[model samples]
Target: MQGAQRNSLRLLQWMMAASLALPIALFAIASTISYNSTLDIADREIERTLDVAHEHALKVFETIDRSLAELNEVVRDLSDDTIRSREPALHKRLKQLADALPQLKSAWIFDANGKSLVNSLASPPPNQSFADRDYFYSHVDQSIGTFIGTVLTPRPPYQGARFFGVSRRRSSDDGSFIGVIQASVLPEYFESFYARIGSDPGSFFAMGRTDGVLLAQLPRLDRDFRLDPNGQVGRSIAAHPVHGLMTIAWPTDGLERRIGYRRVAGYPIYVSAGLETSAIRGRWLTTISQHLVFGLPATALLFILLAFAFRRTQHLQLEAAKRREAEEALKHSQRLEALGQLTGGVAHDFNNLLTVIRASVDLLNRPQLSEERRQRYITAIGEAVARAAKLTSQLLAFARRQTLKPEVFDVGERMRSLRDMLATLLGPAIEIVTQLPAEPCLVSADAGQFETAMINMATNARDAMQGKGRIVFTVHAATSVPDTLAHLSGSQTLKNPGFICVTVSDSGVGIPAGQLGRIFEPFFTTKQVGQGTGLGLSQVFGFARQSGGEVTVVSEVGQGSTFSLYLPRAPADLLPRSPAPTTAPAVAGSGMSVLVVEDNIELGNFAADGLTELGYSITLVDNATDALTELVSHADRFDVVFSDVVMPGMTGLDLAQAMCDRCISVPIVLTTGYSQALSQDGIAGFELVQKPYSIEELSGVLHRAARVKRVRDGAAE
Candidate 1:
């Protein structure tokens, strides 16, 4: 029996070892796959950056070539004597051409003997001889079709700024070598343009000749630098001929980079661009580290639990139950943690706004305050209140309980109108690209909130790209939310509806995988402190869910991110009709009798006094019960009921229902700071004006409600 027990122990030991080994092996395989995938993604990004640089360089070269050709036309057949005769006209023309093109430093027509004929820099052109210049000699043999010469400083009588010439051979009818028409291309011009594209550290842009002479480079070198004929760029150009990508150590700094090189279509020039390999590897390492941070610990814990269960097979069921209980407790704690974060974030923001108002009020209360300072303080107070209101609105949005005024409108039209506004907001550095379909994509949603959500998403994209890169807005129809987002919270609304998907895609440093799940959570941001409030995406998520749809995102670290906002489609019949313009007199209380139901004494008094001032005969009550009693007893005396939604004994909605049951004819208008019932079920067909309303707003709503009541009573009569 003892020998059998020893055999069982050995068998259990083997099972535990095998279980741990399996998971460890699987982990190893996953890491390997991830590493290779990261490298591939890096390569693709390098190639993309290279393509942009190549196109920009090609345009610059083409501009210079065009200028040279235009200059060639004028001086092609002109003899040295004739050119000198028209020297003043040629000089003015050259100056105008150079001024027209930002890339051109100057334009020159060199004589066959290498003497400067009229140039753009000076009239009665300087007696400079370019016969000794390489450009002049290269064109002497035969037309090389716009030869791109090496970088060189202009000789005496001109600025020392380095320039490379784009020269065309000015030949006679016999094809004899005559003179050269050159557009002096400023290398600094290209460098300045490159600086605006992006400035990621360790990233570089370079233009070089096929023979390996460097023309210009960003992160400009102090002294002229040349590339070896067998260097990475030269070899890559020779091997691929047109465009390709490779990894190499930069000759000047010895920093390794994943470079993409492309040869200009009909020029000997090549453009290369890349980010340092170290930066790419650093991003990869961060992703791997995040995985290990979570995965390793969880794996170890899992292995421990399995081993413990194997050793205590008799108590396995009880242990399993305990483990389940622990998991439940853990989930509960996580929920509490989220709640705490929400509460803390709200409190912190509200406190800041309140502090602003409080300080402004204190300053205003001083009797000796200057007129300018008083106006400033008042303005500050108003702004603070506005900010506070916006914050509460955002919080309501996150809770999916904000009161929205939905209307059926074309989404495409709205975006078209909003594009220019967004362009101004994001600034000139960021490019806004649109892919709106020709057909109108109509939806029933709050147009104001829709614009706000679009702006929020665009602002987030701008931040992710560090104020530069592309923000593409694509609008299309989707039968349903993507399957990948079907399991996300608040996505059930999108399951059975045809939706319009508005996608915002950005090419920026992307979100980390671990943080993607929590990005929409209120007040949770990846941006550094003071940079973001983290409520932008939360509002987006809330708006989508509230509008009967969902927002989904797909991101990859180092590649960029795309956010898809789905909004339910409106039926064709729901399209809004434009009503004819009316010249009716402005709405006012006009002695209309109003029964005001407000629980707060001060607020009730304010309403009563404000309405009285606006020509309304007001009856104020503390609760819906008293208001209902007064209204039922003297229903004919009051023309309208102005009531707060939340009150003691009976709510405003309940009071409205009671009045309806009793066959009361008074029109009821409801107001609320916030009400879950009103937000979820709406005002039950009653006119609603939000809380802290102006006297004008309250009077207008009251007069409109009374007018409708009068019209209905007259019709019944």
Candidate 2:
């Protein structure tokens, strides 16, 4: 056991040491590889710099060649049929060519004896001769139309006017050299092109002949340069004939450089653009080192921390255990936030309902009210109660606690019904457009859920437009879902042959591409705080899924957004559609007995007193438990058993089910302010009266239950 304990200690020590130790070694290995990558990237940047300089140089070379060709033709005619009388005209043309080609230092003609015959500046022909000039001497040996000569140095009396020129030999028809027509160019022009590359003092460009004669360089050369194949520029040109880039130390200056070399395609001239290699590499290394410096300390610190953590593991575990204890509290806080949002919407809606109810009641209390106005007020109260009940059901459905009540319905008709409310909510700036079909496609879905989903979609569209744009609601029948619509909503394959497609579109600032996928997520609104709780789209998603449908969206930055909802079409042999309800006269009950079972004492008293006032005898109980005991004792006393769906013990639905099991005959009526029981189990074999209903609606429901009981009893007899 002691040996095993010693091995365990060794293992723990290895675990603690290895955590940071491996990373430190790996970083060292990576540093070498990273250094190479940095240099490789630097090489590409240098190559790009060379490309720009090379392009500018090529254009300059082409212009010089063309200018020399044009100037040669003018010079060839200077000694022709236009003789000494045209010397003024010839001189004028020469000066014009020199001025036009800014690179040219001068344009002139010199005879075979090398005496200046005509000069661009109209200076008298000079007595001084260029008989010994290398160019003049080259014409004596070589038969030529145009010949490029070595650099000219002014000799004897001709001094201080140095020129680098390309000459055209003025030869006779017999091909004997007459003289040379020279277009002399300056060295300073190449300096302007070199300055734009960069301000690195070591970087420079040189113009040299392929034979390795440095004609001109931008930090003007003190003496001519000739490169041997063994050196940098020559080696680069030898490897890449036309264009090349390479790095090597200069034999003359002893400076190491990354040089770009290009040979003038048809000429002996070569241009080399060079940058000192160390300058670029230094910058790259500095940048890379900065990154490494920042990360290396953090890495080493991490290694030290891991090694130290060995001693603090027990303390960390205690902290982790404390964190686990706070998990439930965090979850409770989240639930409270969701509850707050739910209550806010519910309170706002309930206030509107109460306002309608209070207004109607206040109007009814007027002593001398017209009969028409009285009936209208009653109708208004009934309509508001029905609306409130449906709204409550929709909230429950959105919460995923209610079983959907699917009915065959037309989407177009529903959209038409919502226009008045939507217009009022959207305001004058927002134009509502409804392009529904004359005969809407039929789909089976909970009417309340469908209405809620439509309203949610409209609300989102209004918000997206910032409350001022066109909102288009379209309803159409589709044989199958298109691929485009499927991407935003669901699969292309329709389970049924066809579907009822309802689309809500708006011309507004559309959703961003990144946020589109998550818009349906609960509490993820892009709206400002307090403007929205982010539950609108979530509720729409819930309603669509619960009703066996789906919702999709398509949008662009400026174009706007479209939301398409696809619901499975109802079958041809769908059940007979229920006719629309008409306002029925509120008739008082004929002393009908009602057993009112409610958990809340205040609610129970309200129910009992309302029934008593409605010409019905009432038997009240605080809960279903007491109501059940009373039913057992006096089973034949009540004509209708009325109870709230939700209770402390034994719900109204449970009591109704128990009565069915006991073979009781009284008709049951269920009611609630808001209860999942009505949605989950449903009001089967029972009348349902949603809460916040008027006295008239309650009277209607209680009487209906009594009638159902009386009819059943008569059938039994």
Candidate 3:
């Protein structure tokens, strides 16, 4: 045993270690992947910036080259003396071409002697000698096509800003080198344009010569800058020749940067754009740290939980014993709690009804009461009894044990019928709106129960709105259960192909979120004392579930609330093709006999007395067993057996079954205020009338059942 225990402990430790390591490993892998992705994004952004700069540089250089070419054509074979003779015309033309481009500082035509013959800046031309200039000397050697010179500030005699020249060699038809026609581009113009195109701090853009001369740069240097011949940028250019991305420490600031460089199509210049390496890394760190911020705490919490679990495992046997005890205690407490609530609610509602009845009875006993006052008190007593019956019915409904008589009915039609009733119930202050589908939406449910549920919901809505808002009734067909009710709509409970939604929406003071879940509880109410019974929504909830559907609610405080009752969709064929024959009022019992079975003596005597006055011979039994014995012994005497369903011994349903077992043929009619047995098993082919039924209703039921029995008996004979 000791060895086994030791091994178990070791296994648990290993498992916990593995659990802890797994997430850390996965997190590390995810962080690395995310970092790489961030870096790749940074590189791409830099490359795009480089492309923009490259295009700008290419356009500026192309304009200068074209302008220089056009000037070359003008003085292709002209001698220096001839160019000087037409200097006035050439100077004006040069200035016009130069001024056309914002980047260009000036344009010039020089002769073989290296002296400016015509210049855009001065109409008569400056006496400037460029014989010693690198651009001129380079062109003097042979026809170089285009010569790009290094950046230079103007000499004292020629006062101007720093600029670089883009010159084309003017050669004779014999291929002899002539003076160059040059366009001077302002470096500061490129610098200013680069500034206009926004870039992050530590980011830089530069136009440089492939030979490593930096012509113009944002974050301008104190003097001209150049790349080392063997540096990172120089080597990358050599390797790629046209375009590439690189990371290098900038020579000016010694800050590391990730750069993208592209060479101009036919020029010596390369345009590069870069973001500081530190900034790129910082962004990547921020992302990873954000993940860590959440990941670290979660991992720590997991570790703590594991440690607690390990500690608990050491006392597993002790905890198992304690947990069982706690659970049993908890279950017992919950049962008591539920019973207490049910008992309290029942007592509270019934006491109120009894109070009204008691007060009305006291008033009726007045010695000097007038006939009108006496009649009013009687009416009040009757209403109180009816309300008491309704209270029990609602309680049964909330318990999901209300016996229902389901029929296929069109929800749209029912809603249409309720409009007048709703208007009267809600009063003139509340507006009612109906949105019904054009097609009939049929549902299989008790029509009376559905109407009651709707009324309950509407009353709740009216109360929620404080009685001055709009109530909308909408009926629509749905293919499946709503998400809110999906978990509760089990397969056995809801096995229908479709459902119909009867929704009641109101603009009112909405239910609070904390109270929503408890709103359906039997005794739970947000209303103040005497304002409500708190069983209204409970009844709606029960009716829907008992009818193979679900009820759902959505609300926001101070806005409104919506309640939807979903029922199984019924096919049109389920509805009777013809209307059921209405049972006419049976004013008299006509010498018929009824065996009245009721456990309550007062109710039994009342039923017997009422039927006796209706010309029926009544045999009253206090229990279903005695009723069964009476049916067996003198079964021929009773035309119909009227019995209360809920009794002390054999229930009305059982008694009916017993008579059928004995092959007794008598029309049995069952009635109940509420019965769990009838709710679960249903009426089993017997006529049923709910309790507190009127004399006219009971008489009609007896007549119908006895007539059907008589017809069947005649057929048998």
Candidate 4:
């Protein structure tokens, strides 16, 4: 037993040593490799710096060459016989050319005798002769038409310092020589270029001409336009023709630098760049050292603690795994709850769509052909279309696709408008009463959605009454309620601060006690399947919640049901409500050409035909793609583009953008069956008409569109 114990102890010792030793050995090797790799990278970076300097020098030379070429062209033009014959015209052209050339400080033309003809300066010297100047005399004999000579300041009216001259001898159509046209470009332009190239906070660059004259230097040129020739970098560059790099300790800052240099291939200039090596690599080295200094001891302690804590962690991990399983189950339950609510909302919208279609078809089947009969049929179709629009709206609401156009509207006014509809919808047996405050009770919400919710709740109440009870609708302004009932009804349970409340009550069969909890569970209904899809209460719940409020029901099986809705109140100043238009205005077509862009072939054709019949000229296109093509090809042809908002390939918004890109200024009227898609951003500067609109609505939108187009066009003119 003693022998076996000794062997087991020995094996454990070996295992601990092996685990700890491996990482330490690997870390040492890794640190060595990293240090060497950083050195190699530094070398490559020095090479790159040299290449960059060389490229910058070449660019400077190219700028000089281009300036010379431009100057030569101008000089040649001034010396032409055609320009000289028209002396006044020639003077204007010279001034214009001088103003255009940013690199040249000034320009001048001279006769063969070197008398100044025109100078860009405000005043010209009485007599200035450049006949003895090198630029003129050197090119005087050569067949070469142009020459870029050594820099020399021009005589009076142009002189301040030496300038590079580009001179050309001009010949007329008969090959007779004309006076010399010379242009001088200032050296200060090249100095500015060098300044920009070396503007980096840590860098400086300087250039020397082929003859060892410094043309430009950053940190400003000295009196002789030269960098400190005795400096280590300057001496090295002047001595070596081959490119070179070296790390030097900057004398002033005490920071190490990587300095590099290369001679520009075609130019006589040598370029140099220096970057602070310590600034670039010091931080990284310091970080590595910090980790190494602390890590060794920390790692040793961690290994010891981990071995001691192993058994405890094993027990805790088991418990944690079980807890995670419980959480997953809870999340699954939440998902099921959300899915149930969604299903109910979808069913409600589908039923509403079916109701509209059924009503419309029934209207078309009317047998009598009297004028009154035809009018009634048309009205019925209109009502059905309005209902279908409501169905799509509800679908969008359920999907969270609808954007609310919140405006302050008086709750009382909206309720008053529905009184007649309420009477007919409730039938003769139910007594409907409205109790509203004389003062407006206003709330911020989409007026249409709010009205629809009210109608839905009223209809549900009427059904529950079974045609023989009194229903009361009341609106009031209220303060916060206690949390107890608030929690029960899921009312804005936090704190109302203040609110507007609308309540609808029916004295009839109330919801069962057991089923009250599931009243908003969409499709969970006691009614016959064909009688109702059970989305009424669900929609009420969603709409109330989405509008920053809540809907609550208080019911007793034998008594009655009361459904109260809470809405956040609007400020007093925001309470005004616009009255609904009492009657449709006379339909008058604006005399303007209209382009109808709709992807639905039948709908597009119907709209075109209908507009034509209403006395408006119409052009029809199937989609935004074809519409854009037509606009591009014939931009001035259309006055207004009446387009469906949602189409395949390209949306109406895309078409609008394309028109703007092409600078085609025309009014656009966007129409859609899906009003949810016509949010604030979609309707900027354009008129929006809901789909299934009557001829009157179409004409109204067209008139508005035409007026807007005229105003815009007049402004342009």
What would you estimate as the lDDT of candidate 1? Answer: 0.80
Q: How well does each candidate superpose onto the true structure, as a TM-score?
A: 0.40, 0.44, 0.42, 0.41
Candidate 3 lDDT over 1-717, as tens digits, reads 456656776777876787779877998898789879978998888887787788888888887888887788888868888988998998888888888899998888888888899999887866778888777888888777788888988876678799888888888888887777888889898888878773676678888887798888877884377788798778878999888888888888888888888889988788888888888888888898898898889888877877777778768845665765775565344334433444465566579778988998899887999999899888888787776776565445433523688988889988886675566567679999999998878888897788768877888898888989999999998756778667655663555557899889999989989998999876578889756656678778888889878899999988899998988887766765645544456568899999999999998898889888999999997988878878889989989999888887798888888988998989899998877777677788889998888777788889889999999989999
On TM-score, the stronger of 2 and 4 is 2
Superposed by TM-score, candidate 1 places the C-alpha of residue 389 at a distance from the truth, in angstroms, of 99
Clashes of each: 0, 0, 0, 0
RMSD of each: 42.5, 27.6, 24.6, 35.4
TM-score of 4: 0.41
Which is better, 2 or 3, measured by TM-score? 2
The most accurate candidate by lDDT is 3
Off by over 4 Å in 4: 1-368, 390-407, 412-439, 445-473, 479-498, 504-568, 579-583, 586-591, 675-681
lDDT string for model 1 (1-717, tens) is: 345655665677776786678767887887788778877987777677777877888888888877777778777767889999999999999999999988888988998888888889988987778887777889898777878888898788787688988888888898888888888888998888778774666678888887778888877874267777777755766788887878888888888888888888888888887878888778777888898898778778876876786678536545656765775564344334333444455567679778988999888898999999999988887777766665565445433523688988888887886675566567779999999889778898998788878878988898899999999999998855687556542454544347789999999999998999999987688888756667778879998988877899999988999999988887667766755433244355767888999999999899898878768898888888888889878998999999899887799999999999999889999999899898678777899988766676677778888889889889999
> In candidate 4, how many Å is residue 502 off?
2.9
* Clash list (residue pairs), candidate 3: none
Model 2 per-residue lDDT at 369:
99
Local error of candidate 4 at residue 693 (angstroms): 0.9
- Residue pairs in steric clash, candidate 2? none
True-vs-predicted CA distance for residue 712, candidate 1, Å: 99
Q: In model 2, where do residues sit more than 4 Å from their true spots?
A: 1-387, 402-408, 414-431, 444-456, 479-481, 485-497, 511-554, 579-582, 586-591, 598-615, 621-626, 648-650, 657-663, 694-717
Candidate 1: where are CA atoms >4 Å away? 1-23, 198-201, 230-236, 303-717
